[model samples]
Target: MARAHRYTVEVTWTGNTGTGTSGYRDFSRDHEVRGDGKPVLPGSSDPAFRGDPGRYNPEELLVAALSQCHLLWFLHLAATAGVVVTGYTDRPEGTMTENADGAGEFTEVVLRPAVTVADPGMVDAVPGLHERAHQMCFIARSVNFPVHHQPSTSAADSAV
Candidate 1:
């Protein structure tokens, strides 16, 4: 088998909650990010010091990674099966609950995918496709949390 792909990122902290010193990390981007300020991304209206919003949070990123991975796999499978997937969108929600140590953790996550398939019967394969996607999803397999998919859809108007 061929070697798997790899990725790398570096983060740095500058302040502590004790002295009220604000901190920022370099995502290798031109700008910096702060945990206590508003998100730096354009249109990010967070009250925190111009931070980029919650999308940059670790837990949220994990959920998004899983959702994106599943979508990619589903699209690949659909293409191979001669199914035309026109549009795809999903709202993946991650729930944070208290763990045994009294710390909050993402105990559950739900992925609601709205897929447009060419054939109406293709909707029935959503469950199976999701299962297979989950099996191949690297992020889902790496976490201990329970991830569920609540899928709904409409028929694709035309094949592209």
Candidate 2:
């Protein structure tokens, strides 16, 4: 049987510069994303779209969501497979193409994960674990674009 999960987030715009939307550049694309009992996330459009470069944008958030999902699933699978992972880090990148009409969609996302295992014996199993994690990632399954994983595994220092 399948289960359904619902998520809710509230976004409040805070960029009304007095005369709201009076012109093309009248308002800022600043907003706050709030979830129950969570810290407010500052949000804005991409800097190319006249947004604040200091704030997080929707495109970046999407990529982060994908990366986070994969990481969580990878850890869970690693634990269940008896692979002791000492450290894991990812530098995920996403590519988006904009149309002539100023609309865009993500083309692909590449997840570059560097994993350190507790033993050399676990190194060989890391690649298969990443594959399984990708197969099980909900975010990767939900997206239309391709999600690629390039993983590297290293054994932790036994002396430490």
Which candidate has the highest TM-score of all? 2
The TM-scores, one per candidate, come to 0.68, 0.96
Cα lDDT of model 1 by residue, 40-127, tens digit: 4222212233445632555556778889988999888878877777779999998877567756668888988888987887777766
Per-residue lDDT of candidate 2, residues 1-160 (tens digit): 9999999999999999999989979999999999999999999999999899999999999999999999999999999999999998999999999999999899999999988898988888888899999999999999999999888888856421
Off by over 4 Å in 2: 157-160
On the 0 to 100 scale, the lDDT of residue 4 in model 1 is: 88
Residue 35, candidate 2: Cα error in Å is 0.4
Model 1 segments more than 4 A misplaced = 14-55, 99-102, 156-160
| Whole-model lDDT values for every prediction | 0.68, 0.93
